[model samples]
Target: MQPLQNAGYDRAITVFSPDGRLFQVEYAREAVKRGTTSLGVKSDEGIVLVVDKRTSSKLVETKSIEKIFQIDDHIGAATSGLVADARSLIERARIESQVYKITYNEPIRVDNLAKKICDMKQLYTQNGGVRPFGSALIIGGIFEGESKLFETDPSGALIEYKATAIGSGRSDAMDVFEDKYEEGMSLDAAIDLALDAVYEATEGKTSAESVEIAVIEKDTEKYRKLSQEEVSSYIDQLVEKKSNDEEETESEE
Candidate 1:
Protein backbone atom coordinates (compact mmCIF):
# COMPACT_ATOMS: atom_id res chain seq x y z
CA MET A 1 0.00 0.00 0.00
CA GLN A 2 1.10 3.60 -0.60
CA PRO A 3 2.59 5.47 2.36
CA LEU A 4 -0.24 6.89 4.54
CA GLN A 5 0.35 10.64 4.92
CA ASN A 6 -1.58 13.75 6.18
CA ALA A 7 -3.57 13.63 2.90
CA GLY A 8 -5.00 10.22 3.82
CA TYR A 9 -5.80 11.48 7.33
CA ASP A 10 -7.54 14.57 5.92
CA ARG A 11 -9.61 12.45 3.58
CA ALA A 12 -10.56 10.19 6.44
CA ILE A 13 -11.69 13.21 8.43
CA THR A 14 -15.34 14.12 7.75
CA VAL A 15 -15.28 17.88 8.02
CA PHE A 16 -17.80 19.75 5.84
CA SER A 17 -18.12 16.98 3.32
CA PRO A 18 -21.30 16.10 1.37
CA ASP A 19 -21.43 12.61 2.90
CA GLY A 20 -21.48 14.18 6.39
CA ARG A 21 -24.86 15.73 5.64
CA LEU A 22 -26.50 13.10 7.79
CA PHE A 23 -24.85 14.66 10.78
CA GLN A 24 -26.86 17.81 10.12
CA VAL A 25 -30.14 15.97 10.17
CA GLU A 26 -32.50 17.58 12.66
CA TYR A 27 -35.13 15.76 14.68
CA ALA A 28 -38.47 17.40 15.41
CA ARG A 29 -38.27 16.39 19.07
CA GLU A 30 -35.30 18.67 19.61
CA ALA A 31 -37.28 21.80 18.74
CA VAL A 32 -37.84 24.45 21.37
CA LYS A 33 -41.28 25.00 22.93
CA ARG A 34 -43.20 28.23 22.37
CA GLY A 35 -45.15 30.17 24.99
CA THR A 36 -48.89 30.01 24.47
CA THR A 37 -51.48 32.85 24.52
CA SER A 38 -54.20 33.46 21.91
CA LEU A 39 -57.98 33.33 21.43
CA GLY A 40 -60.32 32.63 18.49
CA VAL A 41 -64.05 33.15 17.88
CA LYS A 42 -66.19 31.97 14.98
CA SER A 43 -69.69 33.11 14.09
CA ASP A 44 -72.17 33.30 11.25
CA GLU A 45 -70.36 36.26 9.74
CA GLY A 46 -67.01 34.48 9.73
CA ILE A 47 -64.10 34.19 12.19
CA VAL A 48 -62.31 36.50 14.59
CA LEU A 49 -59.05 36.16 16.53
CA VAL A 50 -58.30 38.37 19.50
CA VAL A 51 -54.90 38.71 21.15
CA ASP A 52 -53.24 41.01 23.63
CA LYS A 53 -50.36 43.13 22.38
CA ARG A 54 -48.12 42.66 25.36
CA THR A 55 -45.12 40.30 25.22
CA SER A 56 -42.97 39.31 28.10
CA SER A 57 -40.39 36.67 29.00
CA LYS A 58 -42.99 35.41 31.44
CA LEU A 59 -46.76 35.02 31.05
CA VAL A 60 -47.38 37.32 33.98
CA GLU A 61 -46.31 40.34 31.92
CA THR A 62 -48.76 39.96 29.05
CA LYS A 63 -50.43 43.33 28.56
CA SER A 64 -52.24 45.29 25.89
CA ILE A 65 -50.17 45.87 22.80
CA GLU A 66 -51.63 44.81 19.34
CA LYS A 67 -51.08 41.09 18.79
CA ILE A 68 -53.81 40.61 16.22
CA PHE A 69 -52.50 40.66 12.63
CA GLN A 70 -53.81 40.31 9.12
CA ILE A 71 -52.10 37.55 7.20
CA ASP A 72 -53.76 38.25 3.86
CA ASP A 73 -56.89 39.77 2.43
CA HIS A 74 -59.03 36.96 3.75
CA ILE A 75 -56.81 35.79 6.61
CA GLY A 76 -56.14 37.10 10.09
CA ALA A 77 -53.61 35.82 12.65
CA ALA A 78 -53.06 36.43 16.32
CA THR A 79 -50.24 35.44 18.67
CA SER A 80 -49.54 35.36 22.37
CA GLY A 81 -45.73 35.16 22.30
CA LEU A 82 -42.87 35.14 19.80
CA VAL A 83 -44.29 37.94 17.71
CA ALA A 84 -41.47 37.75 15.19
CA ASP A 85 -42.07 34.13 14.35
CA ALA A 86 -45.77 34.72 14.03
CA ARG A 87 -45.15 37.66 11.68
CA SER A 88 -42.73 35.67 9.55
CA LEU A 89 -45.21 32.85 9.15
CA ILE A 90 -47.98 35.29 8.25
CA GLU A 91 -45.80 36.89 5.60
CA ARG A 92 -44.88 33.52 4.19
CA ALA A 93 -48.54 32.57 3.96
CA ARG A 94 -49.37 35.79 2.14
CA ILE A 95 -46.62 35.18 -0.39
CA GLU A 96 -47.65 31.60 -0.91
CA SER A 97 -51.25 32.63 -1.49
CA GLN A 98 -50.18 35.17 -4.05
CA VAL A 99 -48.02 32.60 -5.78
CA TYR A 100 -50.79 30.03 -5.85
CA LYS A 101 -53.23 32.54 -7.27
CA ILE A 102 -50.89 33.49 -10.04
CA THR A 103 -49.73 30.02 -10.91
CA TYR A 104 -52.96 28.12 -10.45
CA ASN A 105 -55.24 30.72 -12.03
CA GLU A 106 -57.52 30.66 -9.00
CA PRO A 107 -57.60 32.00 -5.49
CA ILE A 108 -56.57 29.61 -2.76
CA ARG A 109 -59.39 28.44 -0.51
CA VAL A 110 -59.23 28.54 3.29
CA ASP A 111 -58.83 24.78 3.65
CA ASN A 112 -55.93 24.63 1.19
CA LEU A 113 -54.29 27.62 2.80
CA ALA A 114 -54.61 26.03 6.24
CA LYS A 115 -52.98 22.88 4.91
CA LYS A 116 -50.17 24.96 3.49
CA ILE A 117 -49.63 26.63 6.85
CA CYS A 118 -49.49 23.26 8.60
CA ASP A 119 -46.99 22.06 6.00
CA MET A 120 -44.79 25.07 6.61
CA LYS A 121 -44.87 24.47 10.33
CA GLN A 122 -43.84 20.87 9.72
CA LEU A 123 -40.96 21.92 7.49
CA TYR A 124 -39.76 24.35 10.13
CA THR A 125 -39.94 21.64 12.73
CA GLN A 126 -38.09 19.18 10.49
CA ASN A 127 -35.32 21.54 9.46
CA GLY A 128 -33.12 21.32 12.50
CA GLY A 129 -36.21 21.43 14.70
CA VAL A 130 -36.56 25.15 15.12
CA ARG A 131 -38.89 26.25 17.90
CA PRO A 132 -42.03 27.75 16.47
CA PHE A 133 -42.75 31.23 17.66
CA GLY A 134 -45.22 30.26 20.45
CA SER A 135 -48.36 31.63 18.86
CA ALA A 136 -51.62 29.93 17.91
CA LEU A 137 -53.37 30.89 14.66
CA ILE A 138 -57.01 31.29 13.70
CA ILE A 139 -57.64 31.27 9.96
CA GLY A 140 -61.04 32.29 8.57
CA GLY A 141 -62.41 32.34 5.08
CA ILE A 142 -65.19 31.16 2.78
CA PHE A 143 -64.54 27.82 1.18
CA GLU A 144 -66.20 24.61 -0.03
CA GLY A 145 -69.61 26.28 -0.25
CA GLU A 146 -69.54 27.58 3.31
CA SER A 147 -67.74 29.94 5.64
CA LYS A 148 -64.91 28.17 7.42
CA LEU A 149 -62.74 28.55 10.48
CA PHE A 150 -59.51 26.74 11.40
CA GLU A 151 -57.45 26.81 14.57
CA THR A 152 -53.79 25.75 14.40
CA ASP A 153 -51.22 25.06 17.07
CA PRO A 154 -47.47 25.64 17.03
CA SER A 155 -46.87 21.98 16.25
CA GLY A 156 -49.02 22.35 13.09
CA ALA A 157 -52.05 20.49 14.32
CA LEU A 158 -55.34 22.02 13.11
CA ILE A 159 -59.08 21.53 13.55
CA GLU A 160 -62.29 22.96 12.21
CA TYR A 161 -64.65 24.71 14.59
CA LYS A 162 -68.05 26.36 14.35
CA ALA A 163 -66.95 28.54 17.26
CA THR A 164 -63.86 28.06 19.38
CA ALA A 165 -61.45 29.88 21.68
CA ILE A 166 -57.77 29.38 22.50
CA GLY A 167 -55.04 30.84 24.73
CA SER A 168 -54.60 31.78 28.39
CA GLY A 169 -58.21 32.69 29.09
CA ARG A 170 -59.77 30.25 26.66
CA SER A 171 -61.79 28.43 29.29
CA ASP A 172 -63.45 31.61 30.47
CA ALA A 173 -63.83 32.77 26.92
CA MET A 174 -65.62 29.57 25.94
CA ASP A 175 -67.95 29.83 28.88
CA VAL A 176 -69.00 33.33 27.89
CA PHE A 177 -69.23 32.30 24.25
CA GLU A 178 -71.65 29.48 25.00
CA ASP A 179 -73.86 31.73 27.09
CA LYS A 180 -74.44 33.98 24.09
CA TYR A 181 -74.21 31.50 21.24
CA GLU A 182 -77.44 30.75 19.42
CA GLU A 183 -77.86 28.50 16.44
CA GLY A 184 -78.05 30.57 13.25
CA MET A 185 -77.71 33.77 15.21
CA SER A 186 -77.93 36.96 13.18
CA LEU A 187 -74.67 38.59 12.10
CA ASP A 188 -75.02 41.52 14.48
CA ALA A 189 -75.93 39.20 17.36
CA ALA A 190 -72.92 37.04 16.57
CA ILE A 191 -70.58 39.99 16.62
CA ASP A 192 -71.98 41.14 19.93
CA LEU A 193 -71.57 37.67 21.39
CA ALA A 194 -67.96 37.43 20.24
CA LEU A 195 -67.08 40.75 21.77
CA ASP A 196 -68.72 39.76 25.02
CA ALA A 197 -66.84 36.48 25.14
CA VAL A 198 -63.50 38.20 24.71
CA TYR A 199 -64.35 40.84 27.25
CA GLU A 200 -65.49 38.31 29.84
CA ALA A 201 -62.40 36.21 29.33
CA THR A 202 -60.04 39.10 29.90
CA GLU A 203 -62.03 40.99 32.49
CA GLY A 204 -60.87 41.11 36.14
CA LYS A 205 -57.49 39.64 35.13
CA THR A 206 -56.77 42.24 32.44
CA SER A 207 -58.26 45.57 31.55
CA ALA A 208 -60.12 46.38 28.36
CA GLU A 209 -57.02 48.22 27.20
CA SER A 210 -55.35 44.86 26.70
CA VAL A 211 -57.93 43.68 24.19
CA GLU A 212 -57.98 43.81 20.39
CA ILE A 213 -60.74 42.60 18.08
CA ALA A 214 -61.05 41.90 14.36
CA VAL A 215 -63.89 40.67 12.17
CA ILE A 216 -64.09 38.78 8.88
CA GLU A 217 -67.15 38.17 6.77
CA LYS A 218 -67.87 35.85 3.90
CA ASP A 219 -68.67 38.57 1.39
CA THR A 220 -65.65 40.72 2.13
CA GLU A 221 -63.10 37.96 2.62
CA LYS A 222 -61.06 40.50 4.56
CA TYR A 223 -60.31 41.18 8.20
CA ARG A 224 -61.35 44.51 9.65
CA LYS A 225 -59.67 45.51 12.87
CA LEU A 226 -62.11 47.32 15.07
CA SER A 227 -61.17 50.74 16.38
CA GLN A 228 -60.40 50.96 20.06
CA GLU A 229 -63.05 53.59 20.50
CA GLU A 230 -65.65 51.42 18.80
CA VAL A 231 -64.86 48.39 20.89
CA SER A 232 -64.88 50.35 24.11
CA SER A 233 -68.15 51.96 23.31
CA TYR A 234 -69.79 48.64 22.59
CA ILE A 235 -68.46 47.12 25.76
CA ASP A 236 -69.47 50.11 27.78
CA GLN A 237 -73.03 49.82 26.60
CA LEU A 238 -73.13 46.15 27.46
CA VAL A 239 -71.70 46.74 30.91
CA GLU A 240 -74.25 49.46 31.59
CA LYS A 241 -77.07 47.14 30.63
CA LYS A 242 -75.68 44.36 32.78
CA SER A 243 -75.36 46.68 35.78
CA ASN A 244 -78.92 47.83 35.32
CA ASP A 245 -80.18 44.28 35.23
CA GLU A 246 -78.26 43.40 38.38
CA GLU A 247 -79.80 46.38 40.19
CA GLU A 248 -83.26 45.33 39.04
CA THR A 249 -82.62 41.83 40.37
CA GLU A 250 -81.52 43.24 43.73
CA SER A 251 -84.70 45.33 44.03
CA GLU A 252 -86.86 42.28 43.28
CA GLU A 253 -85.03 40.27 45.89
Candidate 2:
Protein backbone atom coordinates (compact mmCIF):
# COMPACT_ATOMS: atom_id res chain seq x y z
CA MET A 1 0.00 0.00 0.00
CA GLN A 2 1.17 3.53 -0.75
CA PRO A 3 0.98 4.59 2.90
CA LEU A 4 2.47 8.07 2.74
CA GLN A 5 0.40 10.54 0.71
CA ASN A 6 2.37 12.28 -2.07
CA ALA A 7 5.36 10.06 -1.26
CA GLY A 8 5.98 7.47 -3.98
CA TYR A 9 6.62 4.44 -1.84
CA ASP A 10 4.86 1.34 -0.56
CA ARG A 11 5.07 0.98 3.23
CA ALA A 12 4.94 -2.76 3.50
CA ILE A 13 7.64 -5.03 4.86
CA THR A 14 7.28 -7.67 2.15
CA VAL A 15 7.36 -5.18 -0.68
CA PHE A 16 10.15 -2.77 -1.61
CA SER A 17 9.01 0.56 -3.01
CA PRO A 18 10.12 2.21 -6.28
CA ASP A 19 13.00 3.95 -4.51
CA GLY A 20 14.30 0.61 -3.24
CA ARG A 21 13.35 1.46 0.30
CA LEU A 22 11.45 -0.73 2.71
CA PHE A 23 9.46 1.78 4.71
CA GLN A 24 8.56 -0.72 7.38
CA VAL A 25 12.20 -1.61 7.96
CA GLU A 26 13.16 2.04 8.02
CA TYR A 27 10.35 2.69 10.46
CA ALA A 28 11.67 -0.03 12.75
CA ARG A 29 15.11 1.54 12.73
CA GLU A 30 13.63 4.90 13.63
CA ALA A 31 11.77 3.27 16.48
CA VAL A 32 15.12 2.24 17.91
CA LYS A 33 16.29 5.85 17.72
CA ARG A 34 13.20 7.07 19.53
CA GLY A 35 13.60 4.55 22.33
CA THR A 36 16.04 4.88 25.24
CA THR A 37 19.79 4.79 24.54
CA SER A 38 21.85 1.74 25.51
CA LEU A 39 25.62 1.38 25.35
CA GLY A 40 28.29 -1.26 25.82
CA VAL A 41 32.04 -1.10 26.27
CA LYS A 42 34.39 -4.07 26.17
CA SER A 43 37.69 -4.19 28.02
CA ASP A 44 40.28 -6.69 29.18
CA GLU A 45 38.52 -7.57 32.41
CA GLY A 46 34.82 -7.26 31.51
CA ILE A 47 32.06 -5.49 29.65
CA VAL A 48 30.05 -2.50 30.88
CA LEU A 49 26.52 -1.61 29.76
CA VAL A 50 24.50 1.54 30.37
CA VAL A 51 20.92 2.61 29.67
CA ASP A 52 18.64 5.63 30.02
CA LYS A 53 15.51 4.65 31.94
CA ARG A 54 13.26 7.67 31.77
CA THR A 55 9.58 6.86 32.28
CA SER A 56 6.64 8.98 31.27
CA SER A 57 4.45 8.41 34.30
CA LYS A 58 4.98 8.29 38.03
CA LEU A 59 2.62 5.44 38.82
CA VAL A 60 4.63 2.79 37.04
CA GLU A 61 7.03 0.69 39.07
CA THR A 62 10.51 1.72 38.02
CA LYS A 63 12.11 -1.40 39.43
CA SER A 64 9.95 -3.66 37.26
CA ILE A 65 11.14 -2.02 34.06
CA GLU A 66 14.33 -3.75 32.98
CA LYS A 67 16.49 -2.16 30.30
CA ILE A 68 19.26 -4.68 30.82
CA PHE A 69 19.15 -8.43 31.42
CA GLN A 70 21.39 -11.18 32.67
CA ILE A 71 20.87 -13.94 30.13
CA ASP A 72 23.20 -16.37 31.93
CA ASP A 73 25.97 -16.40 34.48
CA HIS A 74 28.43 -15.24 31.87
CA ILE A 75 26.13 -13.31 29.53
CA GLY A 76 24.20 -10.05 29.80
CA ALA A 77 22.53 -7.72 27.34
CA ALA A 78 21.11 -4.22 26.87
CA THR A 79 18.18 -3.32 24.60
CA SER A 80 17.18 -0.28 22.60
CA GLY A 81 13.66 -0.11 21.10
CA LEU A 82 10.67 -2.24 22.06
CA VAL A 83 11.25 -3.94 25.40
CA ALA A 84 8.83 -6.75 24.56
CA ASP A 85 10.79 -7.65 21.44
CA ALA A 86 14.02 -7.62 23.37
CA ARG A 87 12.58 -9.86 26.09
CA SER A 88 11.38 -12.42 23.56
CA LEU A 89 14.78 -12.45 21.89
CA ILE A 90 16.53 -12.74 25.23
CA GLU A 91 14.28 -15.64 26.29
CA ARG A 92 15.07 -17.37 23.06
CA ALA A 93 18.76 -16.87 23.76
CA ARG A 94 18.39 -18.35 27.24
CA ILE A 95 16.68 -21.39 25.75
CA GLU A 96 19.34 -21.69 23.09
CA SER A 97 22.03 -21.63 25.74
CA GLN A 98 20.22 -24.36 27.61
CA VAL A 99 19.81 -26.42 24.46
CA TYR A 100 23.48 -26.13 23.70
CA LYS A 101 24.38 -27.20 27.20
CA ILE A 102 22.11 -30.22 26.99
CA THR A 103 23.34 -31.30 23.59
CA TYR A 104 27.04 -30.49 23.85
CA ASN A 105 27.58 -30.78 27.60
CA GLU A 106 29.15 -27.30 27.61
CA PRO A 107 28.12 -23.67 27.73
CA ILE A 108 27.58 -21.76 24.51
CA ARG A 109 30.23 -19.24 23.63
CA VAL A 110 29.16 -15.57 23.64
CA ASP A 111 29.84 -15.24 19.93
CA ASN A 112 27.77 -18.34 19.11
CA LEU A 113 24.93 -17.19 21.33
CA ALA A 114 24.90 -13.85 19.51
CA LYS A 115 24.93 -15.66 16.17
CA LYS A 116 21.89 -17.73 17.07
CA ILE A 117 19.89 -14.62 18.00
CA CYS A 118 20.96 -12.86 14.82
CA ASP A 119 19.86 -15.85 12.75
CA MET A 120 16.46 -15.86 14.40
CA LYS A 121 15.98 -12.16 13.68
CA GLN A 122 17.03 -12.62 10.06
CA LEU A 123 14.45 -15.35 9.51
CA TYR A 124 11.58 -12.90 9.97
CA THR A 125 12.71 -10.61 7.14
CA GLN A 126 12.61 -13.39 4.55
CA ASN A 127 9.06 -14.48 5.37
CA GLY A 128 5.95 -12.89 3.84
CA GLY A 129 3.97 -10.30 5.82
CA VAL A 130 6.49 -10.38 8.67
CA ARG A 131 7.92 -7.21 10.13
CA PRO A 132 11.48 -6.99 11.33
CA PHE A 133 11.84 -6.76 15.09
CA GLY A 134 11.65 -3.19 16.41
CA SER A 135 14.64 -3.70 18.66
CA ALA A 136 18.45 -3.71 18.78
CA LEU A 137 20.59 -5.67 21.20
CA ILE A 138 24.09 -5.18 22.59
CA ILE A 139 25.30 -8.31 24.29
CA GLY A 140 28.42 -8.70 26.40
CA GLY A 141 29.92 -11.45 28.46
CA ILE A 142 32.93 -13.46 29.51
CA PHE A 143 33.57 -16.53 27.40
CA GLU A 144 36.53 -18.91 27.19
CA GLY A 145 38.58 -16.74 29.55
CA GLU A 146 38.01 -13.62 27.45
CA SER A 147 35.44 -10.86 27.29
CA LYS A 148 33.34 -10.44 24.18
CA LEU A 149 30.83 -7.84 22.90
CA PHE A 150 28.35 -7.75 20.01
CA GLU A 151 25.62 -5.55 18.53
CA THR A 152 22.68 -6.72 16.39
CA ASP A 153 19.75 -4.96 14.83
CA PRO A 154 16.36 -6.02 13.48
CA SER A 155 17.97 -6.89 10.14
CA GLY A 156 19.77 -9.79 11.82
CA ALA A 157 23.13 -8.26 10.96
CA LEU A 158 25.51 -8.90 13.81
CA ILE A 159 28.98 -7.46 14.36
CA GLU A 160 31.60 -7.50 17.05
CA TYR A 161 32.46 -4.16 18.71
CA LYS A 162 35.03 -2.85 21.14
CA ALA A 163 32.55 -0.13 22.09
CA THR A 164 29.06 0.61 20.74
CA ALA A 165 25.97 2.68 21.49
CA ILE A 166 22.39 2.48 20.17
CA GLY A 167 18.92 4.00 20.38
CA SER A 168 18.09 7.64 21.12
CA GLY A 169 21.03 9.96 21.69
CA ARG A 170 23.33 7.39 20.11
CA SER A 171 25.28 9.98 18.17
CA ASP A 172 26.26 11.91 21.25
CA ALA A 173 27.12 8.74 23.13
CA MET A 174 29.27 7.56 20.25
CA ASP A 175 31.14 10.83 20.32
CA VAL A 176 32.08 10.18 23.94
CA PHE A 177 33.10 6.61 23.19
CA GLU A 178 35.27 7.63 20.27
CA ASP A 179 37.04 10.25 22.35
CA LYS A 180 37.64 8.09 25.44
CA TYR A 181 37.93 4.46 24.35
CA GLU A 182 41.30 2.73 24.45
CA GLU A 183 42.27 -0.87 23.86
CA GLY A 184 42.79 -3.04 26.94
CA MET A 185 41.08 -0.67 29.37
CA SER A 186 40.65 -2.00 32.88
CA LEU A 187 37.16 -2.88 34.04
CA ASP A 188 37.06 0.19 36.27
CA ALA A 189 38.14 2.48 33.42
CA ALA A 190 35.50 0.91 31.21
CA ILE A 191 32.80 1.57 33.78
CA ASP A 192 33.85 5.17 34.18
CA LEU A 193 33.94 5.66 30.44
CA ALA A 194 30.53 4.06 30.14
CA LEU A 195 29.20 6.59 32.64
CA ASP A 196 30.72 9.44 30.68
CA ALA A 197 29.13 8.12 27.53
CA VAL A 198 25.77 7.93 29.22
CA TYR A 199 26.20 11.40 30.59
CA GLU A 200 27.00 12.80 27.19
CA ALA A 201 23.93 11.12 25.74
CA THR A 202 21.58 12.23 28.49
CA GLU A 203 23.22 15.54 29.28
CA GLY A 204 20.87 18.18 30.82
CA LYS A 205 17.88 15.83 30.81
CA THR A 206 18.46 12.74 32.97
CA SER A 207 19.83 11.96 36.42
CA ALA A 208 21.16 8.94 38.25
CA GLU A 209 17.64 7.85 39.17
CA SER A 210 16.79 7.44 35.51
CA VAL A 211 19.89 5.49 34.56
CA GLU A 212 20.58 1.75 34.61
CA ILE A 213 23.96 0.01 34.51
CA ALA A 214 25.40 -3.48 34.55
CA VAL A 215 28.73 -5.24 34.40
CA ILE A 216 29.88 -8.71 33.37
CA GLU A 217 33.33 -9.43 34.66
CA LYS A 218 35.80 -12.22 33.99
CA ASP A 219 36.33 -12.84 37.70
CA THR A 220 32.71 -12.42 38.75
CA GLU A 221 30.34 -15.37 39.09
CA LYS A 222 27.63 -13.66 37.06
CA TYR A 223 26.47 -10.44 35.48
CA ARG A 224 25.55 -7.74 37.96
CA LYS A 225 23.39 -4.63 37.74
CA LEU A 226 24.66 -1.80 39.88
CA SER A 227 22.47 -0.85 42.83
CA GLN A 228 20.67 2.48 42.83
CA GLU A 229 22.87 3.80 45.60
CA GLU A 230 25.95 2.85 43.68
CA VAL A 231 24.64 4.60 40.58
CA SER A 232 23.90 7.68 42.69
CA SER A 233 27.41 7.72 44.09
CA TYR A 234 28.94 7.50 40.66
CA ILE A 235 26.74 10.32 39.42
CA ASP A 236 27.84 12.40 42.37
CA GLN A 237 31.46 11.75 41.57
CA LEU A 238 30.95 12.83 37.96
CA VAL A 239 29.17 15.98 39.02
CA GLU A 240 31.96 16.81 41.42
CA LYS A 241 34.58 16.28 38.78
CA LYS A 242 32.79 18.55 36.37
CA SER A 243 32.47 21.25 38.99
CA ASN A 244 36.16 21.04 39.77
CA ASP A 245 37.07 21.27 36.11
CA GLU A 246 34.88 24.34 35.64
CA GLU A 247 36.46 26.02 38.64
CA GLU A 248 39.92 25.26 37.28
CA THR A 249 38.92 26.87 33.97
CA GLU A 250 37.83 30.00 35.84
CA SER A 251 41.19 30.11 37.64
CA GLU A 252 42.94 29.86 34.26
CA GLU A 253 40.93 32.88 33.08
The number of the candidate with the highest TM-score is 2
What TM-score does structure 1 among the candidates reach?
Answer: 0.72
Q: Model 2, 1-253: lDDT tens per residue?
A: 4456426443354456666666666777888999988999999888998888888998877788898998888899999998888899999999998999999988789999999999998887767777888899999999877899999988789999999999998999889888889998998888888878887788756578788989988887368989999888878887787779889999999
What residue runs in model 1 are displaced by over 4 Å at the alpha carbon?
A: 1-37, 54-64, 205-208
Candidate 2 Cα errors over 4 Å, as ranges:
1-12
Q: Could you tally the backbone clashes for each prediction? A: 2, 0
**lDDT per model, in order?**
0.62, 0.86
Once all C-alphas are superposed, what RMSD does model 2 give against the true structure? Answer: 2.4
CA RMSD of all predictions: 10.1, 2.4
Model 2: residue 205 alpha-carbon error in angstroms: 3.3
